[model samples]
Target: MTPFRTLTAEQIASLEALGNTAEDWSQVRVSEDFQPFQLQQSRLEGEVRIGSEARIIHSRVRNCQIGEGSLIEDVTALECRHRSSFGNGVGVATMNECGGRTVRIFDTMSAQMAYVMALYRHRPQTLAALERMIDRRVEERQSEIGRVGRNCRIVGARFLREVCIGDEVRIDGASLLENATLCDGVEIGVDVKACDLIAAEGARIGNGSTVERCFVGESCILDKGFTAAESLFFANSHCENGEAASIFAGPYTVSHHKSSLLIAGMFSFFNAGSGSNQSNHLFKSGAVHQSVHLRGCKFASGAYIMSPALEGAFTMVMGHHSYHHDTSALPYSYLIEKEGRSHLMPGANLASYGAVRDIEKWPARDHRKLKRDVIDFDEYNPYVTQAMLDAVNILHTLQEQDPDAEVYTYNKTLIRAASLQRGLKLYNKAIVAALGSMLDRGESNPRHNGAGRWIDAAGQYITRQAMREILDAVDRGELTDPTAVDNRFRIFDVHYDDYAHSWALQVYASLLGHTPTVGELNDAIQAGRNAHAALREMTDADRRRDCSLDMAVGYGLDCDNEEDRRRDYFAVRGLK
Candidate 1:
C-alpha cells in the first residue's frame, strides 16, 4: 500500500547520508528526497515507510507509515503489533463489569446510541445488528501498520503502538498511547496515557490525564489529571480533575472539579460541581447498579447520588442522597435531601437565570475542528423539547391511572399532588415556550413539516414512518449497509426546530383529543408569540437590574459620595 521499492546503491548512499539505518533496507520505503541524515539513531524495522519531508521520527519505528512533512522527536518507541480498528466495535463492559451489557462503540456512535445500548437491553437483535455492522467496518480496514499523518508532530512521546494518527495531530510529552485513532487537529499533551482511544478532530487530552478504552469524540477534552475508563464522550465534551467510568457524555457535558466522580451514568449537556459523586454500586455484591442522569442535569458541590437512579433532564441535585430515586418525569426540578430522604422541588430551575444562560452558552461553545464528526448541535434545540413533551405525556397517563392518589410515588421519587399539578402546568408552559420559539423564528404554521411520530434514530430526530421505510429497505437488502440511515442523520442542525414544531403540535392536539388543523396551529403560534414577548420583557428587566448601581457599588473608584458612585455606575452601564 505504501508503493514500496527496493533501495538501490545510489539510494542507499542517499539514505546513509542522513545517518539512519533500517534492519532491512528493502522493507523501508521512502520518497525521492529521502535523506538518512535527517534520521539519527532511529531503527526502522518491519516494513516502515517514510514520506518525502518527515524527519527524526523515533528511536524505533516498527511497522509504521509516516506521511509527508511529519516531525517526530524525543519519542522512545512507536510500534504496531497488530491491526486494530482503534475504537470501532469496541465493547465496553459497563455496570457490573462482569459483562452483563457491553456498549459497542463506533466512530459515528452518538451518546443516544450509547444510552440505548445501556438501558434498552430488551432489543437484543437490534443491538446485535448494530454491533455486527461495526465489526464489518473493523474487518474492512485490515492493516497492521500504524500511521503518522502529514504535518504531524510527536515530541517527547515515550511510546505509541498500533495507533493511526491523522493529519496535523500534535502529541507532546505523552507517555504511552496504544490502539488509538487520532483525527486531524488533535492534541495529546503532557503525561497523557491512553489505550484504545478514538479521538476525533479538535479533541485534546492533557495535564496528566489517563484514558482507557474510551471514545473521545470531536472537540472533547479530558485534562488536569482526569481519569476515564470505558467511557463514551461525544462532541464538545469537557472533563477535568475527576474520574469517569462507564459513562456516556453527550455533547456539551462538562465536569471540571477534582473530587467529581461521574461513573456509570448517561449524561448530555450536563454539568457536575466540585465533589459531586455517584456510585455504580449500591453496596451490592458486584457493582452491578447503574443509573441514568439524563441531559442537562447539574449537581451542587459535595452532592452525592446512589444509583440505580434516573434523574431527568435539567434536574439539579443539591445535596447528598442515598435514595434510589427516578425523577425522570420531573425535569428542571431540584432533588434535595431532607431527613435522609429525597425532597423534590418541581420546576425550580425555571426561576434560575443560570439555567437559561447555560442553554444559551452551549451552542456558542462548540470547539470541533472536524465538521464531519460533529453530530449533535444546538444543545438546547427542539430535540430536547420533544423529549420533554414525551415526558409530560407519560405523566398524564400516570395521573389518569390513579385519579385520587395523594402523593404519587413512582420509581422512588415522591411527587405531591400540588407538585404534580404545578409540574403539569410548568410542562405545558415549557412546551408552549418551545412552540413559541418555533413560531418566533418565522414558523407561522407549526404543521409545515415533520408530520408524524418522531423516532430517535440514535440521535437523529426523524419521522418514524420514514425510519420504518428505510429499515424495510435494509431488510430487503436493497440497502446493504446503513447508508440511508447515516444520510438521514447527516442533515444539518437547523431543521430541528421545523421538525419539532410539527411533532409538538401533533402531540399537543392529541392531548386535547383532536387532530390539530391549521387554525389550531395558528392558535399555538399566537400562544408561542405571547410567551416569547413575556420572556423578552423578563430577560430585559433582569439585564437592567444586573447593570444597576447596586451591582456596581464596590467597583466605582474615585467617587466622593454615593450619588457620584451611582452616576459613574450608570455612565458605565449606559442603561436607558
Candidate 2:
C-alpha cells in the first residue's frame, strides 16, 4: 500500500479560489507530492485524500479519499464518498450541478446487468447495504480510491449524482450519467448518455446513443443511433439503429435497421428487417397489445404484424398480415400472404434444403466469446419436432372428420382445397423422415449394442420404466428452472447421440397401443429413414425449380431475351 499525505493550507486556499469551497481546511488531505498551486476552489468535507503527483482542479469533494498515483482533475466530488480503495494510476473527471451540490462516486466491480437491475429496482434493501458500505470508507486513508483492476480508463464524463461505476471500465465523451452501474470492460463511446442504466461486462455502447432506465447484458452491442427506454436486453444480443420501448430482448436477439421499432413485446434471436414494425394498439381503449415471437424465427423485410399473435420456432413469415394467426403447433413451416389473404402451407419448408442448411448453420453462428449470465438457448430442439408430429396427427384427424372443409380456415385464414390435400401428405412425410433420421443416426452410435433393448408392453422400444424415469426427472422440478435447463442442454449439445431416436421410440410407443418386437422396431426405423431421405431430395428439387433462370423474365421489364435481361439488370446497376 502507498503512504498517506495531506494538501497544504495554501493549496486549500488556491482550490477555494478556483470555484471550490470547503467547509473545513483540516478535513482536506492530499498526497506528499500534491501541489497547492494546481488546487482549485473545491469544498472538502469530512475527510478527503489526494494522490501523490496527482492534480486536483475545480471540484468539490466531501467524505471521500483519493488514492496515491491517481489524478482528480477538473472534477467535482460532492457528498461523493468512497469507502473502498482504488489501485494506482486511476483518473476521475467530475462536474458540479448548478446549485453547487456534490455527487458520490462509488467503487467499481463488474456484475450482470440483470443482477444489477434486481439489486437496484427489485431489491432496494440490498442497494442500501451497498451504499452504506461505500459510506463507511471515509475515515481511512488506505481506503481512498476504489481499487480497480489493471488497464482501466475513464475520460470525459459528466457523472451526475448517485452512480456506481465498476472496475476495468472505459468511458469516453459520455454525458449526463446518473444512477447507473457500469460493469467491467464496458466501453461507452462518445456522446453516449444514460440514466438509471446497468451495463454488464464486455458490453459496448457506440457513439451518440441514449439509454434510459435499461439493463444491457454481457457482450451485447448497441451502436449508431440506437435508443432504448425502459428495456431489458440479455446476453449476446445486438440492437443497432433502432428504437425500443418497454421491450424485453432475450439472448442472441438481433435488430439492425434504422426504421425498425420494437415496442412492448418479448423477442429472442429475432431478426427484424427494415421497416419491420408491430402495433401494440389498434386504437383500443388501453395499452393491451402484445406479440410473442419464439426462438429461431425470422421476419421478412417490410413485414407488419398485429398484436395477439404467437409464431412458433423456426417459422418464416413473409408479407403483411393483420390477422392474429396462431401457428404455434407448426414448427419449421412457412406462412405467406396471397392477395391480402393469409395462406398456411404446412411442411412447405420440410423438404427444402434451406431448412437443413439453416439447422447446420445456427450452432456455428455463435458470436459470443464470454460466458453468459442467462441460459443459452438450443436452436434445434427435439421437443419442438415432437410437437410438430402431434400437430400433424391433429390436422389429419380434422381432415378425416370433414373432407370438404377448407384446410386454410383457421383463425380467419383460408386454405385451398388442393392445399389441404397436399399439406396432409407433406406433414406425414416429414414425420416419417424425422423418425427415420433419428433411428439411422442412433444405430451408428457406439452405444448401440446389437439393436439395444426390446420393446415394452407400452409399444416402446425403450421400456416404460426408462420413459417414466425421464418424465419423472422433468416433473420433479428438475428441468423447469433456467440453471437446470441450461445444464441439461449443455450436456445434450455435446452427447445428444441416440437421444433423438430414443425420443422417437417413446413417441411411437405412445401412438401404438401395443409394444412392437425388436425386429419390427428396427424395420420401422429403416422405413422411416428411407422416406425422410426421399422427401429431402424432393424438397431440394422443388427449390431448384423455383430458382429457374426463366423465372427472372418478368422481373426484368422490356428485355428481349434472358441474356439481354441479365445484361440490362447489371448495366442498370452499373450506372450507379
Candidate 3:
C-alpha cells in the first residue's frame, strides 16, 4: 500500500469542478491511487483523508478518515467534534439502577469481564485495578479524527459525531449516532438512534431502537423500537419491541414482547413472555432494589415479581410473585402463584419440554461471526448441579423436621409434600447422571481447581477457587491488566472438563460416603445412563402435549372432521 499524498493541483481543480469544496485544499489528502471523479458535491474540512477507491457524494465530512472501498453518500453531518474516546470509557449502571454496580464498558470488554465488574463489588481493589486498566486503554484511543474503516457504507445518515466505524460496517438512515463505536460487521438500520454506545462486532441496531450509554455485545440484535439505557447486553442477546434499563443481559438473553420491561436485573439465557415485568421500587425509597435471574429461566406471560429476589437456574416463573423469595438453591423448579400465595414446586422443570429444548436450541441459535464470549452449552454442568446438591440437602432436612406435614414453607414460598418427595428423586437422579457423565469423559486425574463452589460468570461456568485466584492476582498487582484476567477466564473454559470432573469426584464421595471403586464406578455409569434415559422419556411426554387435541384447537381451522383436523395439525406442525 502506497502512502497518502496531498491532493495535487490538477486533482484539486477537478474536485472543485465536480462541486466538491474543502476548507483548505492543502489539508485534503488521498491515497496514491485515489480517484477524483468518484467524489462529488461534498465539503471536506480540517485535515480530511480519503483512501483509494473511496467515494464521498453529497455529504459534509470533517476531520475524518475514510478507508479504502468505503462510501459516504447523502449523510447530513459526518464529523468529529473534538478529542473523544468514542464511547470507550462510558460507565453503564447495569444490574442495579441505584448506582452501586456500574461497569465501565469498553470496546473489547466481554460478558465475563462485565459480569465480574458488575457482581464482584465485594472485591473493591480488584475492581479498581480493572477500571484503571480500562481507563488507560480508553486514553490510548482518544483521537480528534473519526474513522470509517474499509468497505463501510454510510448512506442517508443524519447526525454522526465523534463515532468510530470499523470494517464492513453498514449505516443506512440512522437518525443520530453520537459518541458511538460501531465495531466490525455492525449494521445500523433505519431510524436507529444510538448515543454513547459501543456496539461490538456483528451487532445490529435498527427499527427505531434508542440506545444510550450501553454496551451492545457481539452478534446482538436490538430492533422494533426497543429502548435501552445504562445497560450491558452481551453476546447473541436479542431485544425487540421492549424496554431494558440498568440490566445486565448475558449471553442468549431474549425478550421479544412489546409490553415487557426488563429493568434493574441480571439475566442470562433468559426468555421473557409478553407483559413480563419486575418492580425495582416499593414506593418506600428510590428504585434501589435489584434482581438476579440465573441462566435458562423464563417468565411466563403477564408474570410479575418484586425485586430483591434471586431465582434459580432453569426455573419457570408464572403469575404474580411479590413475596421476593430467593430460590437460588432450587434449580429447574416452578415458581407459581396460587390464590395470591407463592407456591414453589422444586425440580419440576426437569420434566419440562421447553426447558430441555432451550438447552438444545441455544447453541444452534448462536449467530456470532466473531465470537468473544466464552460460553459452555452443557445443561448439566457443575454450576446447576451444585445448586441441585444444595436443594437435595434442604429438602431432606425439611422432610426430617416434619415428616407428616402436608405443606412445607421455605423462603416465604410454600412447597407441597408431594413436590418435596418428587423433587428429591428428580435431583438425586440428575446428580447421579451428571456424575456419570463426567466419569464417562475419562478425566480420571482431577484438576487442582473446582473443589468447593461453582459460579456461572455470565455464560462461562468456573469454579470459585479459579475465579478467586484471578481476582487475588489482580488485587495483589500481579495481573494488573484486563487482558491478563480475561486470558485466565479463557483458560478456565478450555479446561472446564477437568474442573468439572474434579467437582464430580467430590460429589461422588459425598453421596456414597467413600471413594468409588472400579466396580462401583462402572455401576454408577450404567445407572447414570438409565437415569438420562428416564429423564428424556419424561421430557418426551411433556413434548407430546403440544400435539394434544387441546393444543390443536387453533390448528386445522378449515377442516371439520377429527381425522382431517389431526392431519392438518400434524402436517402444519411437521409432526407425525
lDDT of each: 0.73, 0.57, 0.91
Q: Per-residue alpha-carbon lDDT of model 2 for 1-576, expressed as tens digits?
A: 445655666766666666766677776666566666545554566665555554445555556544443334444342344442221111111111111111122222112222222212334543344334334432221343333223444455554333444545666666665555566778887778786666777788877889876667777788888998766676667889988876657666678998888876667666787877877677754446666676656777877777767676566778877898887677666778889977777656665676666555644655545554434233222555565675676567667778887554765556566765666677677676666556555533444222223211100123233333333444454444223433443343344436555666666666676665688687877877677678768867876665555444555687667778777655654521
Candidate 1 structure quality by residue, lDDT tens digits, 388-471: 676677667768889898867666666667877777766667667766555444342444366665543334455655545544
The lDDT ranking, best first, is 3, 1, 2
- Candidate whose lDDT is highest: 3
lDDT of 3 by residue, 2-29 (tens): 3789988999999999999999989888
Question: Model 3, residue 368: displacement in angstroms?
Answer: 1.8
lDDT of 3 at 519: 93
Error of 3 at 540 (Å): 0.6
Give candidate 3 misplaced runs (Cα > 4 Å): none
> Cα miss at 289, model 1 (Å)?
1.8
Question: Which residues of candidate 2, in runs, are more than 4 Å off?
Answer: 1-150, 351-361, 373-380, 405-407, 429-502, 512-576
Off by over 4 Å in 1: 1-4, 11-18, 94-96, 107-120, 369-411, 414-425, 439-479, 482-484, 491-498, 511-520, 536-576
**TM of each candidate vs. truth:** 0.85, 0.65, 0.98
